[model samples]
Target: MQRNRSKRYRAAAQQVDRAKAYSLPEAVSTLKKFPPTKFDQTVTVSFRLGVDPKQSDQMVRGTCPLPHGSGKQVRVLVFAEGESAQAAREAGAEF
Candidate 1:
């Protein structure tokens, strides 16, 4: 389903030449020209994977740590058993 864009959005989009591929610096410069909005605009991306949902083997799930922190607080949990658990407690870990 296609939805029509607002006149403001269309007008802003028209100012740029679609055929031209912008370098990183050029793209950043172009974006800086846009008028500031009342609230910060959030950008998101979505991908459709070619996988059968019914097949367990086709399911995908995992975590990828960022080289730089993601600007969000994270909670880490480690399971320590037997001697390892005692060592962790002695190391001042919260129970």
Candidate 2:
């Protein structure tokens, strides 16, 4: 059982390493080639950013990277209503 677990972990780690070989820009470009679908509605990328500690909140900022660069040409459908809906629209969100 222990050996099986270790093998599973190693496989997962290898997959991550393969993904790391891809740059953010290249990944985003590849994703863009796909058409929008239910699954494609929300695609997130993860990466670390390099920043100066003194100038920023943290030297390394890590968050889900946008699969594509900002200013996505697709229209967004917001589910909020009333004030929240208005706020969403004000924030450049579409419905």
Candidate 3:
């Protein structure tokens, strides 16, 4: 079933070419064309996959490490011993 969208959303959707696949640079450039808004806006991208997301073998997992840490203190559980523990400590892990 189709969900109702705001007139603003419908207008924005019309700006995009539904048939086109955009590169990251192209997507960023397209976003720049939109007029400024009073409130903060969040952008979300969704991709429908052909494979079953529930299947263990088809599960997607990845990590994006921050360059300068998250600013908040991180709590870590260690399962290392000897040199491995020392190496983790040297890599900015606090005890």
Candidate 4:
């Protein structure tokens, strides 16, 4: 299905060469140059691995913590009442 993209998105897309495979640094630089949205956007990187879901041995899962933290800020929600709520706040829960 075709969906309309914002003018900003179209403009940003135009800046990158679709046929070219950019180095990691070059891709990041291109992304940083894009126009900002009204609200902050999450920077995501996705990969499509052809491993079959039915093959347990081929499943992928791992973590690589960056030496410098990711630029994204994480917001967490806690559901509690009275003392629990206060405890969560004291533990640094944002909301």
Which candidate leads the pack in TM-score? Answer: 4
For model 3, the superposed segments whose C-alpha errors exceed 4 Å read 1-11, 48-55, 65-95
Q: Give per-residue CA lDDT, model 3, range 1-95, as digits (tens).
A: 99998777777788899899888788889888876667899788766667787999998778888787777987665679999998888887775
Among residues 3 or more apart in sequence or in different chains, the pairs in candidate 2 whose N, CA or C atoms overlap within 3 Å are 45-65
Over 51-92, each residue of candidate 1 has an lDDT whose tens digit, in order, gives 887899998788998787788865445588999888877776
Number of the top-ranking candidate, with lDDT as the measure: 4
lDDT, candidate 2, at 67: 68
Candidate 4 lDDT at 58 equals 89
What lDDT is reached at residue 7 by model 4? 99
Instruction: For candidate 4, report its TM-score.
Output: 0.48
Looking at candidate 3, the ten consecutive residues that score lowest on lDDT are: 44-53
Residue 10, model 2, lDDT? 60
The positional error of residue 67 in candidate 4, measured at the CA in angstroms, is 7.8
Candidate 2's TM-score reads 0.29
Give the root-mean-square deviation of each candidate in angstroms: 7.4, 11.0, 7.0, 7.5
lDDT of 1: 0.73
- What TM-score, to 2 decimals, does candidate 3 have? 0.45
lDDT of 2 at 53: 75
TM-score per prediction, in order, is 0.45, 0.29, 0.45, 0.48
Clashing pairs in 3: none
